[model samples]
Target: MKKSLAMLLAGAMVVASLTACGSGKKETTAETTSDTTAESAESKTVSDGETYKIGVLQLTEHAALDAANEGFVAALDDSGISYEIDQQNAQNDQSACQTIAEKLVNDGDDLILAIATPAAQAVAGVTTEIPIVGTAITDFADSGLVESNDAPGENVTGSSDLTPIKAQISLLQKVLPEAKKVGVLYCSAESNSEIQLQMTKEACTAAGLDVEEFSVASSNEIQSVVESAVGKVDCLYTFTDNTIAAGMNTVTMVANENNLPVICGEQGMVEAGGLCTYSIDYYELGYIAGEMAVKILKGEAEPATMPIEYYPEEKCEFVGNEETAKLLGIDISGLE
Candidate 1:
């Protein structure tokens, strides 16, 4: 009886040993599974953190817009974010801008940067879900991109190249103090031009300078319209209208022939043929847009809450084309 009991006890000990071994194997398997899950989660996080893609739509090859593009790219590079850029120029055509924006949106670009007023309008028409940033836009209100200038109030918000009309008027007074009548020249189709022209007229009224708006529907009309204006107003004011900018040589020729000093809306125009300008750096404005884009992509800010920003300060330059200056015979030494 004692021997039988000892054997049974040994048998129970063997069973217990087997059970302990099985539990150890199960624990090893659970640990392996946990490690696998941890590895999978890490890999997923890495894949999710890949590079970003940005699409840029510029209205034309104008110097100001080109500078904005440069600034944007530079800022992106500075952020150390891997990004792919697709840039297209609309050649100052609204329909072309619309088509390019639609293509970019359809291609699943992560963000869109529209460089001018028309370009911004085109992107706004394409998609509201995708973030649209605008730079070099003259007036957001004039383009109907937003409800108010103080707040963009939409998916679209960015920098404005809208030089203060009062400042422009002040510059005009500095250059042509004795002039009573001023002619504002721009393209009729450009909302930016129209808005700037209206502002000019209002500022002129306040400054006691009679202002007449001269609109050209295309480059073909600029020469004739500017000539007519040259005969009418004592001085000329040119806006950053792409059409007018494209035909700057013609306008300059007409103004120079009539001895009328032309004050420009931006520095590029002044650099091309006008007298002087108080304008913001288009490149700086574009960099500001790039900064906003980084914030959006990182989920740090919402476009609706971020009001469009302006250049911290306007940059003024006395870009007097010596030839144009000589022809107009306007001594701007005081402005210099």
Candidate 2:
């Protein structure tokens, strides 16, 4: 009897040992699963105990781009999203833009705010998995940034600075009705400028006017190109060309010297000395982009589904530069 009892007691001890081992394994798995869930939740929460990193890739340092950056950062602050912004400018160089995009991608930027055409293209080309927000991009379709403007159908979406080309042409015609040939001066490298130039050409053609094109590959050739173009055309029209806008005075002085009036794409250009423009509010455009960013950062929206936004027609206005008008001896009495 004692031997049988000893054997049973040993059997019971073995069963207890196996059950404890099984329980330990299950407990370990449960702990690991809990950890993974916590990690996933943290990743989705931008307001978690972490500082989100934003990369600001600007094509160049200009007033418009600067305003866009300021508006984005200001909105981020207002949204109370903890963030660290790494702002960079490519200085209007494609190679530099490419380099910046690569580095930012490698750095694992949570989101990227591309301020212009080249910068947006550079970043969008590098990766499709990352979210990219464009502020002053002219045409997403023409620029090859997206499949369509209404529904971007890509990982990029933001505010478009596409003001009314017809209205701009009308303002130019109104300001200089007798003008026959209008010079379209722009940087050939910027797709935004090219798109605007083509629109202007079409609009000008429809209005029964002749268009003269003056394109330079870079800013260095702007003055010389303008010198040649100013003689052939009655007036000058400058679009949102980063290279040309960099040397604002170069084109303005060349056009003004030849007694030719200049019309521009935005108020900053006019403020820089060009005559007039039916321009969009660049600040407001930036602010809208900022609001979009807030939606993205808060996990409320995805760039993939966000439609491309445009400045409302009411937000765009016919802005005239009184100083430039005086210098060109153009009467402003008709504008008011």
lDDT by candidate, in order shown: 0.77, 0.81
**Residue pairs clashing, model 2:** none
Worst 10 residues of 2 by lDDT: 28-37
TM-scores of the candidates are 0.81, 0.83
lDDT of 2 by residue, 149-243 (tens): 87888889999988788888888888889988988988887888877888999999998889988899988998899899856888888877788
Q: Could you tell me the lDDT of residue 193 within candidate 1?
A: 83
On lDDT, the leading prediction is 2
